[model samples]
Target chain A: SQTIHQWPATLVQPVGSPLSLECTVEGTSNPNLYWYRQAAGRGLQLLFYSVGIGQISSEVPQNLSASRPQDRQFILSSKKLLLSDSGFYLCVGTRFSYEQYFGPGTRLTVT
Target chain B: SQQGEEDPQALSIQEGENATMNCSYKTSINNLQWYRQNSGRGLVHLILIRSNEREKHSGRLRVTLDTSKKSSSLLITASRAADTASYFCAVTDSWGKFQFGAGTQVVVTP
Candidate 1:
């Protein structure tokens, strides 16, 4: 079983401030990691995905970026925050299976 | 663009009744999965149906898939208040990338 851990479950940041959200996976190696954002009462939008270290793919061009420094560590960063960036962020991890394990998620509120 | 689109963006049903939601997709897929998410929480995998399968059952949940139609349906039998949540359908392409639908908000009243 793979467990995904995300830090700072809730965050409130001002516009133009920087942002950093972290996700780590356990019990899996070289797994595919994904970053998603969900607006209030809406479906998820894939922001980025990483298949390996230093390899990141952006599904939608946005103010967010993703990095995979290690096999099990994935990070979401932003140089400056935008009011539209406020949403619930989720981190997912998966091996070769169609099943994806999701983290508890972080609630970001850009003020 | 999203590959899957769920019908009946919202549903309201009483307890002990059955709730059904439909999902339609645009392209070929390797598998389709259903997930449930409570308020302010992460999504939990509910069930998965492959392209070759027609129907699958898991406890009170039933899933039907039609490849020719490029659609699927999820039925929740004898629903409870605990079942009140947002249900999403995700389609996995041949490349294993998953695209999620907007979801159906099911509210089971007691």
Candidate 2:
């Protein structure tokens, strides 16, 4: 059984502050990783995805960036947060192609 | 945008009743997947129906896909209070690009 974990389940930060969210998957290697953000009362928007280490694809050009420093570790970061950045962020790991498993998610509030 | 669209943005049903949601997309797809999201939580993949397949079942859930119509439907039988969540249908293109619909929020009352 594989498990996906995310840190800082909830965050509240002022505009222009730096942001860092980490996601790790245990029991799987070379898995596809994705970052998605959901605005309140809205559908999810894919921010970034990685096929392998140091290979990140941006679905939507945004202020946030993603890094796959390790095979099982994926991180979402921002040098400066925007008020529009306030939303729920999700980390997903897919094994065997397309069966995606998601983490608990982090709620970010940019004040 | 070729993103999928779910009908009945919101739905409320009594416990033990059936709940149905429809999703329509415009484009060729390799597969369509259904996911459930509890309030303010991450999504959980429910089922995936390949373009070659028309229907699939898992436990009390039934999913039907019509490639000709570019549509899909999800039916949850004997719904429970725990079934209250948002349902989203995601379409995956041949290149493995995935796009999700706005989603249908379902509420099952006891």
Candidate 3:
């Protein structure tokens, strides 16, 4: 069975601070990875997706960026956080079909 | 502009009653998927209906798709209080980038 793990389940950060959220999938290789953000009472917004190592696709333009350093490791980072950057961030991995398996998610609060 | 749009942003129903949500997409898709999310949690995959197929069922969940209309519907039978969650329809286009709808928030009262 494959499982995904995300770190710093919750984070509080000041404006203009650097941010890093990590996501790792166990038991899968060359899996499709994606990052999505959800605002309160709003639908999920796809931020980025990675098809393979060193390949990242940005769905929406923002201060945040995503990278897949290793086949099973995906990361979302920002050089400077903005108040609007605060939201619930999710990491998902998919294999075989288009069905995505999502992680618990990390709630980021930018004050 | 969103690719997938779901009707009825919110729905409230009594337990044991059936709840149905509809989604429509603008462009062609290779497949369509439904997901459920509890508040403050990651989305859980419910079902996936391929473009070639019309209807599919799993347990108490039923999904129907109409490629001509570019729409799909999800029906939950004998709903329970635990069924309360937000349901989202995601469309996987030919590009392979899955786009999600605004979602329907279902509240099942016991």
lDDT string, candidate 3, A1-111, tens digits: 678899889999999999999999998788888888998878888888888999998888888988898999999999999999999988888775565677889999999
How high is the TM-score of chain A in model 1? Answer: 0.97
DockQ pick, better of 1 and 2: 1
Residue clash pairs of candidate 3? none
TM-score of each: 0.93, 0.85, 0.89
The alpha-carbon deviation from the true structure for residue A24 of candidate 2, after best TM-score superposition, in angstroms, is 2.3
lDDT of 3 by residue, B1-110 (tens): 46789988999999999999999999889899999999867778899999999999999999999999999999999999999999999988876667788899999999
* Order of the predicted models by DockQ, top scorer first: 1, 3, 2
Best by DockQ: 1
Ranking by lDDT: 1, 3, 2
DockQ values of all predictions: 0.56, 0.42, 0.53
What is the DockQ score, from 0 to 1, of model 2? 0.42
Q: How accurate is candidate 2 locally (lDDT)?
A: 0.89
| TM-score quality measure for candidate 1 | 0.93
Enumerate clash totals for all models, in the order shown.
0, 0, 0
Classified by CAPRI criteria, candidate 1 counts as medium
| Window of ten residues with lowest summed lDDT in model 2 chain A | A93-102
